[model samples]
Target: MTAACLMSTYQPLALSFNKGLGTRLWDQDGREYLDAVAGVAVTNVGHSHPKIVAAISEQAGLLLHTSNLYSIDWQRQLAQKLTRLAGMDRAFFNNSGAEANETALKIARLHGWKKGIEQPLVVVMENAFHGRTLGTLSASDGPAVRLGFNKLPGDFVKVPFGDLNALEHVRKAHGSRIVAVLMEPIQGESGVQLAPSGYLKAVRDLCKRWGWLLMLDEIQTGIGRTGQWFAFQHEGIVPDVMTLAKGLGNGIPIGACLARGKAADLFTPGSHGSTFGGNPLACRVACTVLEIIEEQHLRENAREQGERLLTRLRMELADDPNVLAIRGQGLMIGIELKQPIRDLTMIAAREHGLLINVTRGQTIRLLPPLTIDEREVEMIVRGITRILKTA
Candidate 1:
């Protein structure tokens, strides 16, 4: 197959995997892997989850696409469930995380336009990854990701992650022009960088005081992966707008921008839309995925199993100075090393039958399935211990 035909552009892992279930992946060569990365955090319910697969299969047999012009019962039902889970008034469905974020950005712009602000600005954090769309690319922090894209969207004021003082400084300088503050609860791209304790509460307080919208990009941290339905729950803060995708349908390509309070009323009829946003098939799968997560107590499973994995890793590799940090919440863990270990990602996979991922050159990211068993966790730890000790 040609690279042009495939959407995966020069990706390192040329995976020829044929089958997967739960936490295991088997390639064409008949080798099994303990999948830890979970397809970059999209396969939260796990690959080929029976309920999700059945729902998709059944829905496909019935109706595939009925553009958003008609009423979709499944879409409405899924929206209600998502609203209840995220404590939002409404949701606008899209195709992927970038589209969800694009919708959120439009909501912010509309809010600013309503306020009579000529040049609206949204405050974004350092090391935050929104998505790869033009608008989201402009908002993202990596220069390499934005390289060669001429005239990227302007008016965003960048601030350091977890720094309330920098946020306050920006607010002081551009309070009138700013419409929203957009960020990820945990900076997944920058080595899973977490905010300081009480940072989110402070952000909420500031947003309320300054009359700015607080938007969270939960594309990677939402669903049951973070031991909660959303990571913001851990901080006890509710955003005016929250963007979700990645794990919503367990790889079904659904994104949502949930709006609350004033922001909810910004997007009026005919203002913004998508053709296949809330089609019956995707919505049905999403609804089923949410149900399975709840019914199986995967959130608690993520919490319990994540703690066990992290604890064992810390205890086992405590003596290695190269292991600088092991930090994460629930199943979203990052093992930061003293130096760049990009090759370790390949080594772990090829030699030990483990599938993992590295980010920011030095941090190994783990987005294991929420259904990972204790034995699987031990297997992962054992593999890492061997690789780290020898490498």
Candidate 2:
């Protein structure tokens, strides 16, 4: 717990959970709390689901890692399953969201390289948070995340998320020099900023016109988290490349960048890889996660519960002067306050036994597990109502 023992990288709460199941978590003292955060959307199927636990345990005993030199059966099965779900032709596995994004960015660069472009730029949105690596951080936008990481890698151009005019301007100016458009369907780290309706389709059309690959960062929105296999599916557009992680492995550290069309064949043998990603253990757990999501109908569950939650919150907080707006799709919800509520998460957890996060200064971000039910949604609404009353 002291700085001498471990690096001070995270500002985590003092409370530690010893066990968790579904939407409930028990701290070290056996204090049960309604977990609305769900490890920031990592445990979409909820913590310690029996199927995932069994798969991890079985795979651990059978095999863990065999390097990228040999063929992996579980990895292949997972790639097939993910590509089918994602509507992408091929998948490249990596260790985290950052790595997945890194892979996709590289593919975009290579795509431009095939045409003999010297430096290709990818159009990213302002306030977008792709990842924390040097490559992803370059694609990402946010003052706080980029404060100390100066002179970061840059082949990325920025436009306001959902701003069609700005995007059009970028396309007009950059033209073929822009190789791709990489952005999140719903911006997660800078708060849950959903792209406007029909916005994605517009981007898809523009990408087609400019001959740029459209890469969607689905790290926080994929794996049935946003009530769909992929959030972009809601707009009826398939991205050329899609990066996935977080809920894909349900707390296991694994990620993938799926590609279609010419982008799919960009990476040949020895082009890209990860030492521990998509190993036997992680792939087995991911396959099990997919099976559980489908068998349990978690996607439909998320849509239903999310609508109920959003409706109830809007109704309950309608007249509150401090409430700015309530917005989201499926389980990815956000409550924007009129003033900064940075400490709201701490207060909710400490006093109300509910976990939440504050992002973009005043927005209360809630990403509960997709497996949550109507009853649990009711608890979440009640908890928020009680907490905001104090605010």
Candidate 3:
């Protein structure tokens, strides 16, 4: 009942939730709060959705897990569904976004090795967050996450986000040594920083010109969080490699690394694998989550509600001098303040009865469920605007 035995990995809030449904959560004492975080963009379909719960329950009752040594029907089905949606040819399942990204990194390395590059390099974007693992951390550009992790693998080249010239320079400098480019379509942890218009298409063209795999870390922006099934779709482009997790299983631990063209064929039998990656339970649940998103038309809901929330928040906070910028795509919104307020999360929770997240020191990040309704969108806009105004 206490945190005595847990690791000191997180300085958690002083609250615990006992129940959640849709965009609302109830603390142990039954205090209701609106959930704008969505488990940091994991629960896209919302908390304890009936369909998700039923899928989990049913899958658990049927089968939980079997190692990858054997064939998993649900896993194959999930792979088919995900790859079809992502416009990729193949998928490799994993346990989390970090592992999925690790898979992509390995693919990049192998793709380079096959082309006779001794030490392959992956170009990563500044202020991008891939994951916490060593490989993913190396691909990421966050100082705090990389600090103290001494002597990380140095095969990654860092470039500024949304800067095409920086990428061109990397190409000119690194050239053939660069095997792939890994980046989030929208930088989530550093705040919801989107690339410049047409930046992704330009990057894709650059990758084609340089023979580098275009890898997109869609862990945060995928699975309908950005209105589209994948954020890259917004630009009418498909990445050579895409990593997915978070909302894929609707809270179940599962990740996927999808690839196409030469990148798809790089991973062979012994190249990479995971024991519990695409177990029956996880894959079935993921399939169910995708189904629910489509059946309920949550993608359209996210688009409409996201526009409503963004417009309302902009209108409400536009006059505030402290509000630096208000920007978002679909449900992934961020409100950047002029100064860092580290306790914004605590304040939002305790004072306004809202669950939110503060990222990159000053940006208030919102990843409400894709199923959020118009009324809930208004509530979020009001709650967040009040916090910004009164803070």
Residue 81 CA displacement from its true place in model 1, Å: 0.1
lDDT of 2 by residue, 107-191 (tens): 9989999978898999999999988898888888878888889899878899999999998898778877889999999998877
Q: Model 3, poorest ten-residue lDDT window?
A: 1-10
Q: Each candidate's lDDT (Cα)?
A: 0.91, 0.90, 0.91
Residue 14, candidate 3: Cα error in Å is 0.2
Q: Residues 1-391, candidate 1: write the lDDT tens digits.
A: 4477677555666667999998889999999999999998888888898888889888999998989888899999999999999889999999999999999999999999999998999999888889888899888988778778868878788999999999889978986999999999999998988899999989999999988999999999999888999999998878999999989978888999999998999988899999989889889999998999999999999999999999999999999879999999999999999987657887998999999988888888999999998999999999999999989
Candidate 1 structure lDDT: 0.91
Per-residue lDDT value at 210 in model 1: 88
* Candidate 2 ranges beyond 4 A from true positions: 1-3
